[model samples]
Target: MDLGTSLINVALLAMLFVVAVAIIRMRSLFAIVMLAGAYSLLSATWFVVLDAVDVAFTEAAVGAGISTALMLGAMLLTSRTAKSERAILGVVPFLVCVLTGAVLIYATIDLPALGDAASAANSHVGAQYLERVQADTGVPNVVTAVLASYRGFDTLGETCVIFAAGVAVVLLLGFGERSLSARSDKGRSRKESK
Candidate 1:
């Protein structure tokens, strides 16, 4: 409602759109990857304007950091720096675009407005949590109270899942410089052993 917040939201949206265009139009693989990071940052800022701080944090970390790193690493391991040099005049791509756009438009239609008060998401267990929070939970920060206390087990499980995902990515990426160098050295030394 405040003028500053409104201006910030507008700026965030504009930046998001600009980054989206940059990502789409970029030719350099590295530049495109960095633009994807910029897009994630803008998206996270937009999420923050919507009061989704948790979602924003996840987007900033997982979406921007880890995802961009994975993508760039994959680019390093592969030779294809750009997509196939195919034109978009074909019926198959046209049908796909139309279907995709229609699905997205329908999704936008069903989405709750920016600040709709009566939306089910706004009035659901979130409201219930705020209503009986003091008496039921005796905690101050409801989000922390919910994640660390009420849903502690679920949070623990989710944290474990995230850790597992990180480990999996490490394994898939063959890890970092030290391990990679050691592998090369080991390969060379194995010939000496033989």
Candidate 2:
């Protein structure tokens, strides 16, 4: 990538990191939810920078839009502030996370360098796909052709999964609100009778 792209990526990543830290340190559930949405939006921006428009769209819709709305709905049925509790730093979980990250980084060491023309993926299926996509699907955009024609079922499945998650969130929040209101109504009836 060019210097400008690299700089943009660095700035985005830095902002993402800052937002993540703020989310972790935040005590208010509302603020945390907002920050999480911001994090998702930043992630979508980074995906766009990498030229993954479809993935960016999915992230923005699912992460920033639907997830934030669901969280805000759930928050309506719960406390806005987190309960105060003793902070206990767990060493084992931290170590496990570090070890997992280290293993993932180590695994990537065997992967080919970015945009390496000689990489197996670049030399084989990718090259064939690019060469044949126009002929096979009559789509001018390779990414569109691959996603729409080659991986249509996968895309549809992903869409269904996102839809189901949104429905589930709405149902849960609705049920929670109904239960809370029912209890409040019962309490009011009891108080009036007394």
Candidate 3:
């Protein structure tokens, strides 16, 4: 189990890295959104292999599902293809990404390997969610207890973010329709003048 899950986790982590590169390289906004979703799914798999089920579920929901859906919908409402240029994002994003990856790797170096007995994550507040949830928050199942009681505020914040995204998408949908029509009209006039 250890070797199998470790391999899966590492493979998914590599996929996440590749998808990040692909997202940057993709020319279509729709393709970029889809690649972002693939990255999220890979990250969720990594979280699951690291035994962080709660975080994985949240990431899968917001990142892979809702966020991706909204982004793709917005892309469809906007441009069919993204504008391409030969320019890169300067050097800042690459530098920041390298620094962040280095920091994460350095931080993990001292941590227990996956499935290790001394894995502090497995012995943390998650156990309380499983064992003493009825006493702690009056819920029997740990998932329900955590979502309903412990992290209710965080979920509410996520809901607010989704609501804001919906509003923004609505505005973009209206504006994009108008822009598309105007572009079509201009194209027709240009051809007629020719």
Error of 2 at 162 (Å): 4.1
Tell me how far the alpha carbon of residue 76 in candidate 3 is from the true structure, in angstroms, after superposition.
2.6
After best superposition, candidate 3 residue 57: deviation in angstroms?
A: 3.6
Lowest summed-lDDT stretch of 10 residues in model 2?
A: 169-178
Give all candidates' CA lDDT scores.
0.85, 0.91, 0.82
Model 2 TM-score on a 0 to 1 scale: 0.76
lDDT of 2 by residue, 1-194 (tens): 78999999999999999999998778899999999999999999999998889889989998999999989987987889987778797999999999999999999999997678899988998999998997898988898888778999998998899799779977865445777889999999999999
Residue-level lDDT of model 1, residues 103-175, one tens digit each, is: 9998898888776768887688878888888998899889888888778999999999989988997898646
Report how far off residue 90 is in candidate 3 (Å). 6.3
What tens-digit string does per-residue lDDT give for candidate 3 at 51-138?
A: 7788899899989999899787667657777778787676989999999999999999998865675578767876656677777787
Segments of candidate 3 deviating more than 4 angstroms:
87-101, 110-131, 151-194
How does each model score on TM-score? 0.72, 0.76, 0.64
